[model samples]
Target chain A: MSMYVDMILGGVFHAAVVFLVAAGLQLVFGVQKIVNLACGSFYALGAYFGITAVAGAAAMGLPSVVVLPVLLAAGLAIGLIGLPVERLLRTVYRRDESHQLLLTFGLLLVFQDVMRFLWGPTPLTLDNAYLAYGTAEFAGVRVPTYNLLVIAASIAIAAGLGLFLQRTRTGRIIRATAENREMSEGLGVNSNRVFAAVFTVGCMLGTVGGALVVPASAASLEMSVELVVEAFAVVVIGGLGSMRGAMAGALIVGLIRAVAIMVLPEAEILSIYVVVIAVLILRPAGLFGKAMA
Target chain B: MNLNRRSVLRGIGAAGLSASMPGVFAPAIAQSKPVRIGILAPRSGAMGTVGECGIRAVQWAADRMNKDGGIAGRPVELVFEEETSPKDTIERFRRLVLQEKVDCVQGLISTGVSMGVAPVAEEEQALLIMWDGTTQDGVKEAMPDARYVFRSTDNECEAVMSSLLSVKYFGNKIKRVAGINPDYSYGRNNWEAFRQILTRAGVQYEVVAEQWPKVGTMDLTSHIAALKAAKPDFIFSSMLFADLPVFMKQGSAAGLFEGVNLALPAAGWQLNQLKKSFMPENIVFGHNTLYFALPDASPLQKAFVEDYMERYQQAPHWEADRAYFALAAYKAGTEAAAKATGRWPKLDEIIDAIPRQEVQSLGGPGRFRADKIAEQVFYQGLSTNDNAYDFPTLRTVNAYTADQLQKPPGMDFWEWLKTAKLPV
Candidate 1:
């Protein structure tokens, strides 16, 4: 029973990390009708920034708690950088969706090579936080405390975003714009502003995801492609642009991955792809996604 | 546009006269056509860092040779080809041989990549000096002719045998052993080697538990728990790089290492770096090369260590050092062969020259084995406190000779299995 609890907790933590990045992808695809493949690049950059900040703080003999604020700050910084790109993307809003994807794919390559130029080609570990705070026992199972913190932070962000989207006028206006871009423009809505805002928010989510996972995993050059693929898989499985779907999809993917690691270690590598394919076959639009027709 | 034909002919005659000058093209080619050596390894993937380091060492050796008047006055030119995956290795090898026409090829980090390019090297009749990645069957089965392919890295059999020797160091203290390795050919081969060596050593070992974690497993909590529950005297791990440190960190946090002795065969390079961060204790590990920082009272070792430290800003790992030595041996072999034949020797002549030739390595003198592998020695050391150095260093306890560790050629599998025994 405890083993099952540990696995569930592990699954939840892993889901939360994926959710932080995939939520933004959901929002961008929901509003813009374009697939931003570069969300993974932002996640990787955010993680790299957080690692450098945490490493710098540690070198100056700062406490491990500094990593949290560093992560948030790095996420926001990446979010701000995404603002200009989001503006540029507005020009291609009327273009074909594939054009946006190709542009973002090019950005992904650029960011990946830029990361390699900065961090070299080896994996860097952030075991310092894990080593210092140590493991926390939950239900007789040892879990890294940083992982729990990641879950808590992810929940807070999700709730905050949900409240903002539901309760705020600007948030509703952005949603109104996403519902029908031409209608929102007809009703005197600044569609360009909405697009830029949503894109920035999406990038922020990805950056936060990257920053959060750094304490658990290292920031590698490969993370851009790996994280983006997983994020896209989560977003697609959750329903493109559906927050509830993204959450459910992340949990399913994370649980499946963890369970696969336990039950089928050899097949663990293909577990994610298998899950995505199965989910797609069962529900073409995803669990919580609305049908296009 | 309106120039006359006579003026155009005069211009062409002038260009031809310049082309016919004494030292224009022919003498320039004759004076400085160096032996081109091609290096193929991944430079932009997961294993790029180590691959880049190996290439750097190869280039360093090539530069050093050219500075010392080259091999028989023909300079050695080093060409590096980056391969992103195993699929690219064969294509790149062919390009190097047929197009670039390199005299020799060297440096591969992946066993799959080495095996992929081995047949091409044989078919092309070019010498391939493999600096890393050794599989007992892959090396022998793929390159049975053994005329062109030579491995400098210790084979998996020798690595496992070295780890088994450490079991005897613990003696009856280590009663049982568990194995944790990546679930691949390398992992399975290492586990088999360790089991065979243990059985031949006459030491009783229970199959308490084994965990063949998927390659690149980031989380090791469950595997650590499984190993802890078994409570073997020691654990033999074939995990390398990121997986190695992840397992060690989780194992330490879970208190798995508190009661158990850990024996890792491939824990040489990165674990040493992780020691400063993790402070690993009470573990007896085996590496192909140990005490790499110590000069062993040899000028060659001292010079190489000092130069490496100055260049890389860190101590040279066994991988880096072995590659340096392999390149040095290649130079030495070429020099000897060229002197005897008065021309660039063929693959067979180079292989023959390697065994008869010796070169000063960072570890000591390295020659060729009858099995066509590097006749290198192995050492087992304990990680002890170093009051003088910045980091903890390995103190040598045992040194195994190449002859004792190597299996003789022409021995069948059954005969080799019967003769295989752990040296204590």
Candidate 2:
């Protein structure tokens, strides 16, 4: 029973981060009609930048207890790079899907090299900040207290994002624009501003996820590329452009991975893709994804 | 004097034919043509940092060799290509040999890429020296009678040495063992070899948990939780590159290594990044063949370390040592062949001379086996922060010679482990 609890909590921790990146992917695809494969790059940037921010804060004599807040702030700030990136992404928004993929894929490669230049080739991590809050024991299993906080934070972000999208006037306008961009433009909505804002928000979701994960994982040049694979798996399984699907997909993928690691051990990654393939075969649209036209 | 098309074509054909025939003008060709060594290493991915380390060392090796009058009196030229996936690397390997006309190819860190390029190297008849291919089974299976391929010490060596080191120190305490290795041949082979040694040594233990994440996996939280729940007394992992630092950070945070005896056999490549704060003091870290802080460093080791630090702005690790070993082997082999035959050695002559060639490596004195595998010392040590160095250095360092660490020439590694008496 304790083993199961530990496994579930572990899965939840992973799902929290995966949900953020998948939410960003879903949002960009929902409103901007552009599959931002570079969302993973934003996450990696967040992680790398988070390390710098924490180190800089520590150097300024800030208490180690402030590591979480500092990482969140760094993630949000670094995510603003999505604004300029969205501008570059704007050229392909009206173009074919191939063009968007090529541009974003190229951006992913470019971001990898850029991070390499900034952080060097070695993976970077905070020295002692991960355990600043200490470990919490439950059912004889110890988990980092930081993990619980990140999970709570992710849930809060998810609820806040859902509320903002469903309840706000700007949310309706953004939805209207997503439904019919030219019509939204005729109705006096600046689709450009909406796109820029939505894309930046989406990027922040990914960046925040990346920042949150760095406490537990080192940020590397390959992190961007590797996360892209898992994020895509989540997006595909949750149905494209669906926020609720992202949540559901993230949990399923994460939990399944956790279970697989415990059971088969060899099928850690293979098990994730197996479900992905099953979803593709059985439900062409993901678990919560809307059926395509 | 006649400027007809046929005459000009015949003149060009004759010139090209003569240029292609090195035997006709051997001395002039040897003197004029630079000895080009093709270097293939990952420069932009997970292994990029360590790959860059190897590249810098090989570059430094070339410069040092040229300073010492070059290899066989010919200046060294290195052509580099990225060692990515096996397919892309194989394509690059072909281009490096066929297009660049390199005398030899060196520097492959991945076992997959090395295995892929092994047959290609033999087909192309290019003298290839692998800097960090550590899979013995793959090598034995793939290149059975390989004449043109040489490799670094096998992964089994480090695994056996690490097992010996672990059991010798903590055999009485360890009862339950777990593993979290990368889901690949290197990881699988390391764990298997380590397990085989433990079982062979009559250490009564049960495997509590096993996790095999892919090579570039960033998250090991679930794996850590599972390992914690299983409550193993010892955990063996073969993770390296970015994965090692990530595992150390997450595992330390979750208190996974609090009471567990961690054995990281292939982690010596990550000594620089595995700082003192996060890395536990009691864990056993294997540096393959290169111990950066050997109590008594040789002149070559001291020179290599100081020169690498000056040139690369960091301490040299096993990757750099691998590069140094490969270059030293090439130099020794070519120079010996040149002296023996009274001229520049041909490709086959150089290949023949490379086997059984002795070279003083950064680790210590080393000799290549008749099968082109370099036999060197393996070091395993406990991390100590109170050392003289800025980073965490090793204490209670144990060095195992090749005889004790490696399998016999014709015997299987597992079979040899069953009867081969280990130091432990």
Candidate 3:
């Protein structure tokens, strides 16, 4: 019974983090029509920056309870890095998909070295902030209260994003641009600004995910590349350019992983890919993805 | 000769070749030539910091040797290359030996890498001193008759030692055992060796849960939850990288550490990164062959700690200590060979002299056995916050002698462990 509770909580917590990064991937691809392979770099940057931010916050005598908000702010601030990255990516906007991939892959490599230079080679962790929120009990099983908060936070963000996209004036304009860039431009919408905004928001989602997860995990040079693997898995399983797909994909992947670890430990990673293959075979467009015209 | 275009080009080519490939041209040049050592260490990934520490120690070794009139009276020159994957490393090894013409090659931390490069060393006839290749069972099985390759002490020593120390500290209370090790050869070997020793020592315990996360797994919440659910009295883990710190964080947050006795044999490598708040009281940590405090009054250790702290602003760990051993062995063996032959010795001569020679190290006296493995005393101890240092220090230090833990030469590790007796 406790094991079942653990599986559910662990899976949900993991899904929350994965969903943020995947949502970012979906948004960028939806609007820009470019696969930002450097999405993982943004996540890594946020994680490292989150550590620094928490340290700074602690030195300022901020209470431990506020660590979550501080991390979110740090993630959002660091997300501005996407502005410059998006600008640089503009040169390859009209180029081939291969060129975009190669360019982003190059950025990923460069970001790794740049991070090493700034943070050193050792993995950085946020120690005090992790247990700050404390743990909660559920039917004899103990879970971190922070995990629950992050789950709630993720749901709130998902709803907020969904509402904004479906309701707001700017959101509609952004959606319109994503739907048809040339048509939106003819209607006097600034597609360049829209792309920049969408890319930055997408980057923020990744950074925030990284920031939130850092307290529980670590910020290592390898995290960027490692996260890319999972994020891609989420994107493919959910649908390439669909936000709803991102959420569904993350949950499925996360729950499957939790279940796999419990049953067959060796197939933890293999199980995710197996489902990916199945999803690709069964629903080539992904669970929530729209079928192509 | 006529100054034709072809002749001019030929002359330029010859001059360039002579200048760039001096080792190829000047094979007969005696004395005053530098003794170049090729070093391979991971410089840009998870192992980078540990590798950087090894590089610092080797550089210090070279500096000290030069200050004392160099290795065999030749100034030491180090040629460094990043040790990436096995395939890339093999190519780098060839470049270091064939292109740069280094006298000796050293420094491989990964067991997989050591297994890959050991045979290559034999093929190239290069003197290879491995700073770390902890897999005792696999490396021995792959190259039992290796002449060119010399490795540090078998990693089994530390595992066995960790088991002994854990039993000594928590033996009476431990009824259930669990493991959360990296899913790799190194982690598997550590857990296997530890389990063997514990089971063989007649410490009856039930196996509850075993979690083998991939090598770079950052999140271990599920593993922690699994362990907590199993309610293991003692947990053994060999996650020595970023994963260790993450596990500690997540595990502590989940309150998993409170009731569980943890034995982490490689946690000393991440001693600095570990937090006092997250650390459990009843845990035993292994340092492979290093204790930052050194404990006893050894002038060599005192000097090394002081010098390393002043230079790098950090305490040296097992990687640094291993690097020192590698260099000290090379210098001792090379000098011995030279003294015996009355000239700069060959690779075979160095190999012959190494086992016969004893070298002093930070960990104390060290010497290779006839099987070409260094005999090192492994350290495992309880963590204490009573120390003045910012990070937690080891208390109740226990040393496990290599002879008691290591398998006898020409014997398989698992086969020997069945009949092996450790002092309870």
Candidate 4:
């Protein structure tokens, strides 16, 4: 029973990182009508910024009370850089998506090389926060406290985003803009502002996801490239532009991977790809996604 | 001073030109052509971090040897190529040897690349020294016919045999064993050899869990929990490179490695760089093909480590030692062959230089056998960060020697394992 609990917890922890990154990509596609290929760079940036910020905060002899808030502040500041990135992206909004994709793909390479130039190829370690709380026992099985926080934080973000979309005026306006941009503008919703605001929030969520995972897993050059592929898979399997799809798809992939590690071990990665292919064949609209018609 | 690729070529070109021009440059013409060595290493990819170390070792050995009067007064010239995969290796190797006309070639730490490059070098008749190819298939099955290919690192068989120290130390505790390795040829080979060793040791060992995650796998959460549930007394791991820290961090957090004896055959030497405060104790840092330190280790090993520190301001990675060992074998073989032939040794002569001969190495004295792979002995050590150095260092955890860890003569490795009594 404890082993099962541990496996489920492991699945949740694994899913948390993927869902958070994919949800933003889904949300941005809803408002902007464009898939940002460079979203992976934002995720990598978050990890790099997170470790640097966390270390800087600790080095300043700041109280531990400021740690969580400081990490949040660093994450929010990173989203602001997306404004200029979006402005560069604005040029391709009216143009073909291939242009936006090519431009963003170029940005991804540039960001990767720039980070490599600064940090070199060595992996960065800032596992201090991850080690701070130590392990918590649940029914005789040891659970990493950092993993629990990641699980809870992902749930909180998902629930909060769902509520914001359903209950808040700004979110409703954004949703209306997503459905019909010109009609929302005709209804005086200010469509451009919605696009900018949606893209920013999505970027923040993606960045936070990366920031949270870096404390446990060391920040690596390969992390962004791998996450980008998984994020696309999760979003594609869930439903493009659907937050619920992102959540559902992440859990399914995560659980399958977790189970595979226990049962076959060799099929851990292969299992995830198999489900995505099966889902695409059966339901192209994804689990929570609505059909185009 | 360091010589880049262009300058070394320019010097060679000048020497070649001077040889033709008679009177003015006749003294330079009398000097034999530089014995050029081509180095194929990854400088831009994922393995570049360690690959560059091999390149640096080549240059360091070249400079030091050249200053000390190079082999038979023929100045050694080293050329470096950034190579990644087997295809990349073949392409860069062609350019290095066919176009540049290098006398010899040294390659990356990957076994796959070495397997591909072996036949190419043999067909071209260029001596190929692999700095770090630890895969058993390279010598045993992959390129057995290729006489020119050589390596100094311990292959999969010797690596597993070295873990016998851990078994003897733990005694009855090793009744149940688990293996956590990457689901690839390298890791599979490690497990097969380890399992065979345990079976032959006459131990009633039952494999509790066998976890083989795909290459570049990041998460090992459920894998850890499952292993912890198995409650195995020992876990043999072949996980390495960037995947290590993630395993160490998450595996340690789940208390997977706590109180249980662990063996990281591939990347155990890297444990010294990790912090002692967070690291798992009792990790059997099994002697890799060439670890820097050994109990009653060779004097040449001490000189090599000190030389690396003096030059690079840090302790050398084990890959650097392998690179240095390749150079040492080349130096010994080339000098011996040159003395016998009374000129620069030919490609075939270099291949036949030190067969069945032993020479000094980074870890100790290693033998260049008939198969062309330099067979070195193994010794076990413990993982610790707070030892004698700033980074993680071993404290000579065990008292076992090469004879105890190695497969003795007059029998096959498996045959000897089945019959021979292990020395404790």
Candidate 5:
């Protein structure tokens, strides 16, 4: 019974990481109608920066409490990188969607190679700060404080973004653009600026996701494709552009994977694909997505 | 726009004269052509960097060979072909054989890639040298006609049995065993082998839990959690590359290693790579054949290590040692073949002469088996600090001979697999 509770808690933690990445992917795809394959690259970059910052801080005799903020700052810096890329992407807005897809794919390869050149072909690990000082008991199961922190941060980020989108003028403008870009442009919304802003936010969220998971894992040159493909599956199954849908999708995938590991270990490899195929067959537009007329 | 009849006639005469002189054209053609060795491996996909190391090792070997007066007194050249996807491996292999006209082909990091290229090599009658790919079915599948295919690395079954032997050495101190491996052939085979060996050894193993994350998985927290929940006394992790470090970091942070003994067969080579990232004391490390780097105190091993470090500016991994030994085997086989036939023999003739061919390797002596896989002796070692060496090195604890380590021929793999019953 305790083992079962631990597995569920573990599943929730895994879901949180997936939600952070999928939320950003869903947002970018929802508003811009562009599948930003480079989100994976940005995620990897964020983790790299996070690990470097933590190592650099420790080298400089900084307290461990400063690590999380340093990681967040690194994530924001990666978000700033999206500003220039978003501007470049704007130039090709009038081109076919395939052009954007190809550009992002090219960026993915370029970023991965650039990282390889900078960091060499070795994996780097960040020391455990969260586990050193934090622990919590839930449902008679002992869980890492870091896992709880990730879950809380994910919820806070999701709720914070949800509220901002629901009540803020800029958020409404982004949503309006997502609904119909032509209509938003018709209303003098400066759709290009809106696209850039949405892209920046999306990239920031992805970076934060990477930053959040860095302490638990090392940053490597190979993380780009694995993260991006999984993120794509999450957003597609959650509803292409819905934050709520992304969270739901991430949880579903995460839970399915965790359950599969316990109940059917042999089938764990195909668990995600099985879920994605079932969801697609049942609802082509996803769980929360509206079908295009 | 101005043309002269005399000039046109002179041009035609010159062309005719050059065409008629075959001796004049000989130097030009000979200078342009060089003996080419083709390299094929994944360079941009899941197994990219691992493949990159194999490619680098081959290039380094070819360079060293060329520096030593080349093969047969002619310059050796290398032509690399990158296979980005499994779907394109067969076609790319065909192109290397039919168009590139390579003398030898090497480099495969995954079993899938090896299986894909075996038929192509067989069809073209090209000599295929496999560096680091393992599929148990490969030897039987390529039998009778696929004599040109040869492997230099240990198979999955050998690796699994090696890990189990290490577990046995640890003995009753280990209470339970868990596995964290990728859900592919390599991972599955390792798990199956470990389970079979453990059951046969009369060791109690409750799989408590197993995690089979997708290949190339970046995050392994959930898998780590599953492992922790099992609360096994030891773990046999088959995760490679990025996932390996990720799991190690997470496991370290979660205090999962506090009371656990961890044995990772694939991570022995990676210990040096991650030395700067993680503390060596925080985790227990064990692997198969600590390679030439083991604390052997042999003159030959010392010379090889010192020379490799001096030349490459970094310590040599198992891949480098294996590459050097493979070349050495080739040299020994070729000499034996030459001695027997009194002439330079073809690849088959050379291979046939390699059954009992002996060569002094960085890791002692090695020979070829009936399956075409090299029978290199391996030793299990524990990580230990040596005052003699600046860096940490593996201290040999157990040496398993080739006969003891590997399964005998003609034994059914399934019959071996039937021993994996759980201790209920």
Candidate 6:
């Protein structure tokens, strides 16, 4: 029972990292209709920024309490880097889908190389400040309190996004533009502005995901490819335009991989593809995605 | 890219003439030609740390050789290449051998990249010296066909056997063992070899748990939890590069190594890369390698580390030592072969000469087999932070011979393990 509980907790925490990345991919696809292959770069940049910020704070002799906010600041700073990139992406929006992929894939490679030049190839580890508090016992098993913080943050982000989209005026405008860009433009909505906003938010959330994860896991150059590949799977399985779909897909992938790690190591990655193929053959929309009319 | 009959013959003519040149390249040496050696290591991935160190070491050795009047009195020219990924390894390797026409190539870090290029080297009849990749069993299998390949680093079996033997025979209450390794052929191979040795030795022991995380996995929560649950006395790891730096922090935070004995085959000095604020405790590394904090086995070893520290302004990785040693070994072999055959001998002669002569390293005096595998004394020790540097490093250790840990002479590794006595 305890083993199962621990596995479940592990799966949930793992899912949080995947969800943070995939949700941004989902958001960009929903509004801009562009699958940012470079979404993983944002995640990686966020992680590297977090490393810098945490290191800077330590150098200044700040208390460990300063690390969390510094990590958040790092995420926001990485979000700034996405602005010019989003403008570059805007130029290719009218091109073919292949062009978008080629451009973004090129960015991915550039980002990886740039990271290597700056940080070298070794992974840099930056500890979470909350780790000082030690493990919190739950279900008769000791768990890192940082894990709980990450899980709660993921949930909070999900709920907060839902409310923002449904309640706020700006969020509704973004959603309206996503539904039908030309129609929304005819209704006096500026699609370009909408895309800029959506793209920035997308990059921001993706990087924040990276920032949150640095505590639990360190960041490295190879991380972008691994995270991007996995996030792509989540986006594909959940349907490209659905945020909730990404969360659902992440849980399924995460829990299944977690269980597989315990029971059958071979099935950890294979089983995710099995479900993907099943979804393609059966629903074709996703576990929570809406069917196209 | 098109191969024409004339072009093929022209290329072949150049190659054959280079090979059959009279007076062992001395004429070229006198006429301003240099002995070219190619080196390949990762410069843009997580493994880049070692690659950067390797480049410096190779240059350091090559520069020193040239200053001392070069190889065979011809200045040694070193060409460095990136082993970017295993996907492009063959193309890069061929470029080094055929296009640039380097006389030799060394510094293969990834086991996959090295294994991928071994057959190509053999086919080209090039002198391919493997400096630091440790997939011994697979490399050993390649030896019968891989005529030109020789490794300076100890293989998986030889590297880990000493410490495993010590813990099993000499320790107290170490009956349960668990392992956390990167999910790859290298890690799986090490685990399989280690478990086989433990089981065959017939100790009162059980492997309580095992975790094979994907190679670049940063999240080790589930794996650590599983290992902690198993409650083993020792946790062995084949984790490398980024994984080790992360493990030191997270594992220490989770109290993963509070009482349990932590063990690693290599990359143990990865702990030294961490800050003093976040370091793991009481790790028993399998080898007294990881150059930054090694036992001074010889005067050469002492001078190398001191010189390396002065030159680089930081502690050199064991890879730096290995790279230096590989070039030194090549130089030694070339000299020996030249003395015997009265010319710069063929690739076969150089390959044969390398194993016949002993190579000095930070670990101690070592030699190679005809099959190109290593036979040397290894030191395995528990690690402690001396606080001499910002991070912790290894201190005390127990020494064991390659003959004791490695497979018996002229017999297969598994076959020998089946009958070998428990080293009491």
Which stretch of 10 consecutive residues in model 3 chain A shows the poorest summed lDDT?
Answer: A120-129
Give the TM-score comparing model 5 with the true structure, all chains together. Answer: 0.82
Per-residue lDDT over B1-424 for candidate 4, one digit per residue giving the tens place of the 0 to 100 score: 1121122322222233332333222233225567677877765444655676666666666666665555556666777776667886788888888888887787667877777777787788777888776325622455545577785444564455445755665656788898888777778767877787776666778999999876556677878877877888898887776566677778878887777887776564343335554566656665454566555656766766678777766566656666766877787787777767766667677778866457666666666667675566555566666566544456555543344554443335556555656664
Each model: TM-score of chain B? 0.84, 0.90, 0.90, 0.84, 0.79, 0.84
Candidate 2, residues A99-204, lDDT tens digits: the string is 9999999999888778877787667767678878988986777778999999999999999999999999999998899888999999999998999999999999
Off by over 4 Å in 2: A58-61, A138-140, A281-283, B1-33, B134-139, B310-313, B389-391
Docking quality of model 2: it rates as acceptable
> Could you give candidate 2's per-residue lDDT for residues B323-396 as a string of tens digits?
88898899888888887888888888888888758888778877778878778877888767887554567878
lDDT of each: 0.69, 0.82, 0.83, 0.71, 0.66, 0.72
> What lDDT tens digits, residue by residue, belong to model 3 across residues B346-398?
88899999989988877677888887888877777887877776567787788
Could you give candidate 5's per-residue lDDT for residues B160-277 as a string of tens digits? Answer: 5455555556655656888887787677777777776666666766776677877656556566667777788878777766667666656665557767776666665554444422
Clashing pairs in 3: none
Choose 1 or 5, whichever is better by TM-score. 1
Model 6 lDDT per residue over B45-87, tens place: 5676777776677777776666555666556777666776656
How would you encode candidate 3's per-residue C-alpha lDDT over A51-101 as one tens digit per residue? Answer: 999999999998999999999999999999999999999999999999999
lDDT of 6 by residue, A52-137 (tens): 88888889998876666788788878888778888899889999999999999999888877876676566776644537446788
Q: lDDT winner between 1 and 2, please give it.
A: 2
TM-score of 1: 0.87
Q: Assess candidate 6 and give its lDDT.
A: 0.72
Top candidate, metric TM-score = 3
What does candidate 5's lDDT look like per residue over A77-121, in tens digits?
Answer: 877778888988886677899998999998888887777666654
In candidate 1 chain A, where is summed lDDT lowest over 10 consecutive residues? A260-269
- Cα displacement (Å) at residue B26, model 5: 23
Q: Model 2 clash pairs?
A: none
RMSD of 1: 7.4
Better of 1 and 6 by DockQ: 6
DockQ scores of all models, one per candidate: 0.29, 0.45, 0.46, 0.46, 0.30, 0.47
User: Per-candidate TM vs. native?
Assistant: 0.87, 0.91, 0.93, 0.88, 0.82, 0.90
Rank the models by TM-score, top first: 3, 2, 6, 4, 1, 5
